[model samples]
Target: MLVRKARLPDADSIHALIRSLSFDGTLLPRTFAEICENVRDFTVVENDRGEFAGCGALHLYGPHLAEIRSIAVTPRARKQGAGSAIVQALLAEADTHSVSCVCLFTRLPDFFRQLGFAQVDRTALPDKIYKDCANCPRIHACDEIAMARGVLPDIAVLGPAQVEERLIPLQL
Candidate 1:
């Protein structure tokens, strides 16, 4: 299998893969337009035959934080190291951008733990809270665990004050 930065032509496959997982809320649903608009953020894995196997995206909030989102592998590609390769490639991309932290929300903590992520309080990720969690359909009943690799950012650019204020009651 091979992993590489996603190209425009890969958008349909990536959209389908993410949509397949989103049906049960395994991931947030993304429109095909969203995938195309942010296609540069995605990395895709292809089987030896050069067929699309899986994909993941790295959304950089800044030098302070980057997020791994929309990560999913086709059912047939599971256990073939495609997922791991995609993640490593994303992390490398983060490193190239000098991002200090990488975060993700996942139901599969064990999978990410093996990849060097540790559980972190969702509130500790203010930028994420502001960007997605604040309006997430599952906000009050979220099942995904927040995890991070590397030092958590000390600051947030997107409404940190508002995120903190809103999250306070949730923590209580």
Candidate 2:
């Protein structure tokens, strides 16, 4: 399989993969518009025949915090290393940008553990909860685990104390 930065033409396929998982409530739903707007954040994996295999996105929240979102592999492509390749590519992109840390909310903690992400309390990332989880239907009964990797240069950038102090209630 080949992995590369996503292009506009890849949006439809990426959206389909994400939509399939989201339909089962395994991931957050992303609209075609949303995918297009953040298209640059994604990396796509394509099979040798040029079929889309999987996709993931790195969303920068601030100088020190970025979140990995919308990771999904085609069901037929699962266990074939497509998921790992997509994540590795996203993390590598994060490293290239010198992002201090990468965070994600997922049900697959084991998968992330293999990628060096450690389980973190959701409370530890109030900013993320406030920004995304608040609007999520599962917020009150979330089954997803929060995980992170790398060192965040400035904890204050997303510290709960700081987030509360500068809190602005609005839909993000």
Candidate 3:
């Protein structure tokens, strides 16, 4: 498999792969427009024949943090290392930006763990909480595990107080 930065033409394929996994909440749903708008954030993997195999995105929250999101592989690409390639590529992208940390919320903790991510308290990622978790439908009953790699950012660019307030009830 070959991994490279996604181009505008890859939006539909990326959207389709994400949509296929979003039904069961494996990923948050992303509109085609959203994918197109953030196409630069995405990295795609292709089989030897150049067919789209999988895609992932590196969402920068300033240099302090970056997120790995919307990663999914086509059914035909499963177990073929497409997913791992996409993730590695995203991590490489984060490195390019000199991000202090990389984070993700995932059901597949073990998969990410093998890539050097360790479980982290959701509250430790205030930027992510304020940006996505506050609006996430599964906030109170979130099944995804929060994980991170590299030094955790000590400063919260978003509202940490508000994030704490919102997450308090979940801990109850």
Candidate 4:
């Protein structure tokens, strides 16, 4: 499969893929407009025949932090390295921008562990907490484990953890 940066035309398919898993919280549901707005943040994988295989995104919170979001491969694409390739592309995207750390909330810790991420206290990602977590219905009882590929250079960059700006409204 060829892994490359995602474009505008790819948004609908990517949204469909993520939405398929969002109902169970395997991924957070995103709207078509939201996907278009963040399309620059994503990288997608396509099979040899050029069909959508999987996608992942690198969302920057600041110079100190970036989060990997919506990484899901189609059922037929799993175990074929499409997911890994998309993740590696997302990591490269972070590195290219000089992000000091890359963090993600996932139940699939082993999958991320194999990609060089280490388990981190959820509090270590204050920006994520300030942004996404505040809107999450499970804030008081989150099941997802937080993981990071690098130490956050400065937590201050994340701002206040307990306060929510509600800057971006998300759909569960």
Candidate 5:
């Protein structure tokens, strides 16, 4: 398998991959336009024949914190290491940017735990809760667990205060 940074042309495949998995509510659905806007945040894995197999994205929340979003491997491609490879690529990208830590919300905590991630109280990440959660349809009834790998710099001092001040206090 080959893994590489995603290009603009790869957005459709990436969107389809995530949409396929979003059926079970394991992932949040993303629109084509959102993918286009954040195309640089993605990495994809392809088989030796160049078929799109899996994808994941690293979303920058601040200089010190990033979130792993839209991670999914094609159902036909499971158990072939596509998911792990995509995550490894995302993590490597985080390292390249010198991000202090990476966080993700997943039902599959065991998968992330294998990658050195530990479960954390979601409440500790007010920035994340205020950004995505406040607008998410399932925020009031979220079933996912939060996890992180690497030591995060104190996010309060890492710029989240600005985010908190701007929060609109939506009821989600």
Candidate 6:
């Protein structure tokens, strides 16, 4: 499979992959406009003949962290290294930006564990919680496990205090 940075023309294929996966609650649904706007964050994989195999994205939270979002591969593409290639490419992209660590919330932690990710407490990723979890429909009922690769940064911006301020208090 050939893994490469996504361009504008790749948006539809990427959107379809994410949308198909989102139905299972394995991924969050993304709007077409949002995909177009963040297309730069994505990397797509295709077969030698250029058939779309899979796609993944690295969402920059800051210099300290980037989140791996929306990684999905077609069933037909399984076992072909498309998913792994997409992730490896995204990790390389993180390294290029000097990001100290990459984090992701996934049900497939074992898959990521083999890729150097370790399970971590949600509290350890406050910036991620502040950005996505704070508004997520599953916030109070999330099932996905959090994982991170690389050492935690020395910077303190995304820690508890910073996140608490941004959280909207909820009442049942």
Best by lDDT: 1
Residue-by-residue lDDT tens digits, candidate 3, 94-165: 988899899999999999999999999988998999999887777899989999999999987878577677
- Looking at model 1, report the run of 10 residues with the lowest lDDT sum: 163-172
User: Pairs clashing in candidate 4?
Assistant: none
lDDT of 1 at 108: 97
lDDT of 5 by residue, 1-172 (tens): 9999999999999998788877889789999999999999999999888998889999987767889999888887889888888898888889988888899999999998998889998877666777777667788899899998887547643334655666648667
Candidates in order: C-alpha RMSD to true structure: 5.4, 3.7, 5.5, 3.9, 3.7, 4.0
lDDT of 6 by residue, 1-172 (tens): 7899999999999999899989989888999999999999999998888898889999998899899999999888988788898999999999999999899999999999999999999788878877778768789999999999987654535555656766758666
TM-score of 3: 0.91
Q: Give stretches of model 6 more than 4 Å off.
A: 154-172
- Each model's lDDT comes to 0.93, 0.85, 0.91, 0.88, 0.85, 0.88
Q: Of the pair 4 and 5, which is ahead by lDDT?
A: 4
**Residue pair clashes in candidate 6:** none
Model 1 pairs in collision: none
Give the C-alpha lDDT of model 6: 0.88
Lowest lDDT sum, 10 consecutive residues, model 6, at: 153-162
Model 6 residue 115 lDDT? 93
- Estimate TM-scores for all models: 0.92, 0.87, 0.91, 0.91, 0.88, 0.89
**To one decimal, what is the Cα RMSD in angstroms of model 6 from the true structure?**
4.0
**Model 1, range 66-116, lDDT digits (tens) per residue?**
999998899998997889999999999999999999999999999999999
What does the lDDT read for residue 133 in candidate 1?
82
Candidate 4 at residue 86, lDDT?
A: 90
